[model samples]
Target chain A: MPQITYIEASGQSTTVNVPEGWSLMQGATANGVEGILGECGGSCACATCHCYVDEPWLAKLSAPTEGELEMLENTASERKANSRLACQIKATAALDGMVVHLPESQE
Target chain B: MPMFRFDPYSPLVDADPFPAYKTLRDEHPCFWSEEAGMWILSRYHDIVAAGNDWQTYSSARGNLMTELPGRAGATLGTTDPPRHDRLRGLIQQAFMKRNIESMGDNIRDIARQAAAELKGRKQIEFISDFSSKFTVRVLFAVLGLPMGDEQTVRDKAVLMVQSDPKTRAKGPEHIAAYNWMQDYAAKVIAERRANPTGDMISQFSLAEIDGDKLDEREVLLTTTTLIMAGIESLGGFMSMFALNMVDFTDARRQCVANPALLADAMEESLRYNTSAQRFRRSLQRDVELHGQTMKAGDFVCLAYGAGNRDERQFADPDKYDITRKPRGHLGFGGGVHACLGMAIARLAVRVAFDEFHQVMPEYLRVQEKLDWMPSSTFRSPLKLELSIK
Candidate 1:
């Protein structure tokens, strides 16, 4: 299990262990963390689960797909270079202790 | 010349479009339909690309052929980002997945009563008796409408999306239906505003975006859109789910034996036979694809049904196997304008399946004659006769 840290916009942090193959959105949502909507049920069809990846782990993650990128542009929050839909990021052992920042609002 | 002559208006194609979709994906990935007056993209890659490329392929024109271009801010589905973002942001909280999940019990209860009423019947009309009734009940619950008026509201909702030849020619009838819906919504909005009932409609009345609440016209249009979008396709989907159950005995058996597999089976049915066959998108600029140049203002049909069955995306595309775990299917569509009522749709299907299986797990298709509702986009039987065995 890889421990994932979800930091809210107000700087509240909570850590949870997510099994491999489960998405970070699933991890945060299942653990009852606020700010990640996952409205499309992790289909990447809705960009409600937008989050900003910390600089240290940004390079390790694959580039956002064209669909995800287009959807990211529709996020309620401003899009940064490290912004990604948490549903598109699968948890892996190498990503243990990774930090993700949630936007203030997903709508 | 296009490899396949595809006429979406033809009854034959509406009855079973998978064959035509296969032809389009295999021979002409970017085939142009003269009858529809739009370019049809069938392959999964092309369909996904066109849906995501909001700049080149625009929905601001309208997603339906009956609609004219440039009515961008009128509806959530018709507009692009910035505007779409602001409008959706105001009401998105009401339709969130968690909130929909909380309504599962009520949905299941509606399904249970509808299914129970069919007891001791030799032949049951699935659409009117079960699917439509169940769907309208859920719609009423979600919309905070009076349950006693379900039948009349259901009829109006149907006519709002009616695209049959006779109905299409009768323009006033269509306008009358639209007015009835808007008028009904206006009454509901007024009542909710006068007295905060805490229903979804009331929530819509109170929801404020950037210190401004949705205006009267926006409220009515948004409410009417939700009702129209929720009823027809969902009713059709439930009918199709029942059809799939009888068509595939082994798959159905596996689902009934293990309740967990029911969700996967429902998803498989959606992929195998999607209710929404096609949606239109206009070109924002001149673009070339498959040796053809499509200029701005040109309309194209994104064939989601064909894209779901693309061989490049799914192995053994024609097979309906529940174990396949069909993910990333374009059943609910893709990109920004993806179906807003998807959570409601999924909840309706799940609860209906659960309640139906609990009461009558075994059923037989009694009617050999089947006729699909004639529409350019949607596909479902007008009536389905089933016998509980």
Candidate 2:
């Protein structure tokens, strides 16, 4: 299990152990993290699970696919250089100490 | 010992299928339905697994058990991925939550107008007078279609999904409605292509990706699919929710008192009695479940209504609880081929109820014997006469 920290827009932070092969969005939503809605149930169809990756861990994760990039354009929150859909980022041993910032609203 | 019977098309199952679903889930999770000539997956986990594995259970063949002629592989619901992904990507932009939320005021206005019409009525036919009218108007507004022809379009859309129980196939009227909608959609696509107005149809007509765009046939099929789903499926859901409210007075009272709970109530209604009862997927490979082997090329029906009420998934699956927060329920189906207009449907229903409850806070079913729509795929009260004072 890889532990990931989810920091909400209001500065409240919660850490949960995400099982291998589970997406960060799944971990946050399954563990009752308030920030990520995961409305599309981990499908890249809806960009409700928007998040800002911590700067250092950005490069370590896999790059967003074309489908995810297209969906990102529709995110309700502002897109930044490190912005990503948590559903696209699967949990792994490499991302054990990763931190992701939640957007103000997922809509 | 006699084998348990489960026929989706049977009037008995149509009236109340939950008990039969319970039997299927408990005794035969992957039972074969002899009447429909298809495999039925009734358990929650099994349906979800099958939906998620599109490669094993493909939609390219057809999504509907009684699929319309010339429908498979043409529209979003019928197509499998890569192509499905491409079509969805191009079409979903218009249905994004942010985009749909922007139409909130317009939706609310339509709802208000519809609710206002029943101000002095002692009794009202909910499906015809309110739910159908409201959904059709909202869908027309979204598509930028002219309003006067709603009655005609709504009738055709309703008939399009229906099948003849005796024949166990689509009736002539169904095919006629399908053809009419095809011609109607083609006209709309051409008109939108010639004069783009930035509406959903226009967006579909002009949406491009990497120098590729939807062709005329694709645009026509997509438009027709939306119109049919927008009117029949979405309107059916609204009627189902209304029926739930009427049946569950306590839950309804809670929703009325705290308007904020309306969204959750709507979701619970979706889980409790989803209008989308069943959808079919063709098997790409042989699969064994519960000692039954479903061979490749066999069609399997994913009973979403049954899956939502599975005790293994939700506690007290039969009870309608607004506070349950039944997330991940197959109310909107699941996997890559989930309902595309879900956000729109949610916003429309929430706003409609908010406006409706404001006008008629209390109502009851006037008819003791209710008639349900005769369709295997969709379920709703065909006519609901409600007494409103």
Q: Which candidate leads the pack in DockQ?
A: 2
TM-score of candidate 1 chain B vs. the reference: 0.93
Best by lDDT: 2
Docking class of 2: acceptable
- Cα shift from native, residue B92, model 2 (Å): 0.9
Displacement of the residue B129 alpha carbon in candidate 2, Å: 1.0
In candidate 2, how many Å is residue B147 off?
2.3
Candidate 2 ranges with C-alpha deviation above 4 Å: A1-35, A41-43, A51-62, A70-83, A89-107
lDDT of 1 at A84: 96
lDDT of 1 by residue, B1-389 (tens): 73468887778877888888988888888888887788999987687667656778887877865552222446777777656666776676667566677888888888889888876776788889888999888888876777787788778776766565533322565557777888887888887788887577788768876775666666777777777777888988888888998889898888788878888888888788888778888998998999888879999999888988999878898998988766657776765666777878887898788777787778888878788876677778888888878
Q: Identify the candidate with maximal TM-score.
A: 2
**Candidate 2 per-residue C-alpha lDDT over B1-389 given as tens digits, one digit per residue, 9 for 90 to 100:** 88798888877777789999999999999998999999999997788768767889999888987999878888888888877887778878788777777899999999999999989888999988899889999988998887788999999999998888778889999999999999988888878778889689998789888766776677788889899999999989998999888889898888889889999999898899999999999999999999999999999999999999999878899888999887777888865777888889889999999899998889998989888877888888789889985
Position A27, candidate 2: lDDT: 74
Give stretches of model 1 more than 4 Å off: A1-107, B1-3, B68-72, B165-172, B211-215
What's model 1's TM-score? 0.80
